[model samples]
Target chain A: MTQTDLAAFLAHSVELESEARERYLELADAMRAHHNTEVADFFMRMAHESGLHLEEVAQIAAENALPDLKPWEFDWPGEESPETASYEAIHYRLSLRQAIQLALENELAAQAFYASFAQSSADATTAELAAQFAHEESQHAAQLSVMLKELPPDDAHHREDDDDPHMPE
Target chain B: MNDVITFKAKDYKSGVKPIWCPGCGHFSVFNAVTKAMAGLGMNKDDTVLVSGIGCSSRLPAYVDSYGFHGVHGRGLAIAQGLKVARPELTVIAMGGDGDGFSIGGNHFMHACRRNVDITYVVMDNEVYGMTKGQASPTTPMDWDHSKLTPHGPGVRPFKPAALALAAGAPWIARAYSGNPNQMAHLLAQAIEFPGFSFLHVLSQCITFCPQQTDWKAIVNERQDAALEDEDEAARLFLHEDGFQTGLLYQRQRPTWPPEAAPPNDPDLTGGFRL
Candidate 1:
């Protein structure tokens, strides 16, 4: 890949990984704030895994001429990527299955993005890297599927305190 | 040739993750600010972030730079003092609507007229999120969700941008959280301006103002394709949709750096004895 292309790819990949890590951390925080200890722990673990992936992505980026893309300059398809859930979307009562579904959807989107990049890129090294990313995302999707299946059905919906100040009186 | 510098948005962000609600618009503003700082290639050590009390005031804690989370409604005063003491530092103040327009209203007015070379970002979320749900200065008159004001405040919302312009603010603009790119660009511009730059950001409290999610659709770029004059900008604001995002006004003004003066003489009582 040309230097500019390499820089763009590195920025793109790092942004993807960083956003994914941020989303997991956000989910963990939201769950914890809502007092859902089990789900919060699960999200925190997932966040750590994503943080590791982010570190690997950053290392890959360091090997290239990555230009610093400003917050507004990132070539992301959306303000943020699919795997990164919106902070407002999560509820304290969210089931583990629901969380898995969100993760699975994000992983699938990431996989699609990587696959498209791999197929379209003319640079052999870039294509190889894209393919590797696609494979990694696929693995994440499969893991989410297993987690989803293992989760027990949710039953305690009204466990929240009725006198919560946030609740409309 | 420009001196090449290295920094990233992540570098500006502190290791601490914000504990705000998931959809709080402050996150986007935080993202935009970091991107702006990175884009400007500002040295972290040469910058100082001062913030007043409230959820948005917590911003300084999350950014990896010299920051002072000051007392309630005192961020502007603190930032002004810091800028005076260390004129070389790039000082910025951040606060919520209530912190800026209510408790700090007097300071806000004086700061604007002072024309200090500092950037002020007011994240107007309409309602007070940190104190649960309370109608704020920027809260719309018809927002009757809060039990405190079931009938709504029924008062005209504070027009921050217009007030800034009227108060002779040299640089003024509005931004939306949903549009991170535009916000970042505006923030950079604000930081680059010489005198006081007041940026009014429409940050939504997602927990209290869930319906404000449509702010993305409502926000549009400024018309006329330029930020020419105050009259034109005010005309655009009054006639066109207030939701339009862009640099609304800019004017060259003298920065309010304190003038150097002779030092005070020693007290006669201490030197000559009483």
Candidate 2:
């Protein structure tokens, strides 16, 4: 169901940012465990950005009396929030460029999600809030795209075999 | 206004990163568990999670609740003991297919027969993931991946839902980890059920059984309503393909530790006296 009020809209936004932050942190931890420090650091920075976004959403939520929706109660378009990266898209050997691309795609999806809400919301206040969120997400997407351009392209030979593959005998 | 403090799914997480492969379906199972707990408004301190040895067994570590990473195949026994001793605690026993059906197979049968008030979640990946890639009890007979088996285990796979029905479990449900939202709903229902509840989660191990990635397209939600009668449930279970997801059976039965106390015996402590 479409979020019709400011409280419901902010609740969705908070969840979206929080889940994205947690997923990015999880990816960073996994990358570090795999000894890919460069990619790990990149994911960590992305996670930090998500954390800041979460704080911003939380502040907006505090300004309004948000309804506490259970995890299963939200009308998320998918199984999870739009900004959270799909677990299947991550790999232990992911490159820095690929990581940035993943973040960029997530930002684009979040932007689209808020844009749709802004257009479809029935309540005037909800629509205005959604539009503001959508504009912020659009800025984030633009910034990510610019950052993606600065990263070096992935090399064809960069896919190295694990020296100690965790394979069963 | 409801004064209850609501929690998000992340609140149930311990913040420990799972060491499983990046895309392993176990990640979704983890997410589902946390979501279920949050949905139930369950107090983490009052819940206990137990697991046997396997990749899926590492779940307790990731959850921010009371947990026991017990010895291989003894998760059920430990969980049962905990439930009997502290009947107030919500206990959930979990492990991989091999850990639950092979080494702990007998316990699975007894747990069902006893109808204890606990939820057992078996992450059925059909292969032994932690051991690199061995043929598990639920692996299809024709699967020939392991050099050890060379030509597969040459035995029919174990049917968990049917076995639970035969063993007398009060509730049985199947879920796919890829669909975390549905899985979370099923898990919450299982936890709230009065007696023994068996939740069979088809969590694919991408590293060992990469072909199972197609399971996303194959798994169909159960069309028939959950059956209360044993005969009808058994018939529906036998007729459908194993990939069907959703509650298959539910029948209320007397849980263990019956309210009526056993007759007092003077000789009860005689055997224990040295």
Candidate 3:
């Protein structure tokens, strides 16, 4: 699909960030449903952080017209937000460190997606904007790595609960 | 800025979030469906998805399109009727292996034979995930995981793709939730197809069927490029040892729509009853 006008692209970036934030919040809710309080709290923290990033993206709009993209209109290669996809692949019994690993993987993928756009684009302005987005994603990856490093060591024997009610007995 | 306000896939999702178990594969199927719809630039108002009773049947509630959560095993019948009446609209039917094959088994066969212009997405988790857990039609024989069927349902399991093909379905394919991009592409193609299209998605029911979580690894081992020839596709589909993933067959067939006769009763007036 052709990229929309500059202002719309900017708005789309903001929406993309917002989607990330919303996805984090949804993950938090899912963790709570599974009664994984620690994981839920971690996702909530990530949601708050995403919310702050979304605010920064919104600031870039500055009265520019943001194109309206329907849920199906975004040119994302994946189905949903990067964070959402990573979160869906996680289990309820994951530790904080494992959650952080999942988050880091997503951040790296997001960074790569933006970097690809930045490096492949022929338009100077588009490439510049993509580069800026890539840098932002890089910072997220670094931050997640630091958080992961601060976690306590985990026992190799620690395994998740095998009997989920949803599973057939 | 002058462009009309476009909605993203997120916008199409309903406020009522999915109650499906976290890590369930249906979420991926849902994501693929919405993504395919978004890729097509379909008007939400112009689209309708109907589903029967089951865990996978809840798909309609998650999307913002016109939806009908019909009774158990009756989704195809309702969706077909709706499409025949409103040929201008895009219609889709969704359900699980049990709902589509067990209770609604008869409808499943005829819908393919009728050749209605609609898409049917069956989230085949093999074992029924809803109502706790039960042996489904697609559950393998001699693989008993359920307390209800202590030694498995020894009868041979139903193979959806083969049945669809044998039943004369014009479009038949198998997809795995682990490969969302390819599944989304198949869904898009199925939606655009002229006659009955069956998309069998191997979704994991993480809560009830933990074994399915490894389906990604299993599915990764099987990938065939889309085939353009029917004879070649038939050979690949008919001779396969089961467990392949790709568009198995696609054939052009005349779509059956509702008769164009006008309403004749006086009760067909434009006014509504007070």
DockQ of each: 0.33, 0.41, 0.30
Each prediction's Cα lDDT score? 0.80, 0.87, 0.77
Write the residue-wise lDDT of candidate 3 on B1-274 in tens digits. 1135455556668777777766777877887887787767678888999999999999999998999999999999999999988888899999999999998989999999899999999998887777878889988787567788878889888878777776778888888877666787789889988889899888887766677676766664245555656667667666765567777777777777645677565576544546
lDDT ranking, best first: 2, 1, 3
Candidate 2 residue A59 Cα shift, in angstroms, is: 0.8
For every model in order, what is the iRMS?
A: 2.9, 2.9, 4.0
What are the C-alpha RMSDs, in order, of all predicted structures? 4.6, 3.4, 5.6
lDDT top scorer: 2
Q: Candidate 2: lDDT of B190?
A: 97
Candidate 2 lDDT over residue span B190-255, tens digit each: 999999999999998776777787888899888778899999989877766789999889989899
Q: Which residue window of length 10 is worst by lDDT in model 2 chain A?
A: A160-169
Candidate 2 regions off by >4 Å?
A: A147-153, A157-160, A163-169, B1-6, B261-274
Pairwise TM-score winner, candidates 2 and 3: 2
Pairs of residues clashing in candidate 2? none
Which CAPRI level is candidate 3? acceptable
Q: What is residue B65's positional error in candidate 3, in angstroms?
A: 2.3
lDDT by residue (A20-69, candidate 3, tens digit) is 77667777777788788888898898889878877876887766667655
* TM-score of predicted chain B versus true chain B for each candidate: 0.90, 0.93, 0.88
Per-residue CA lDDT of model 1 for B1-274, tens digit only, reads: 0146667677788878787876688988888888888888888888999999999999999899999999889999999999988888999999999999999988899899899999999998898889888999988898887898887889988788777766778888888887666889899989988889999898878777777777877887776444658887667656655687788888787778757565476564565655
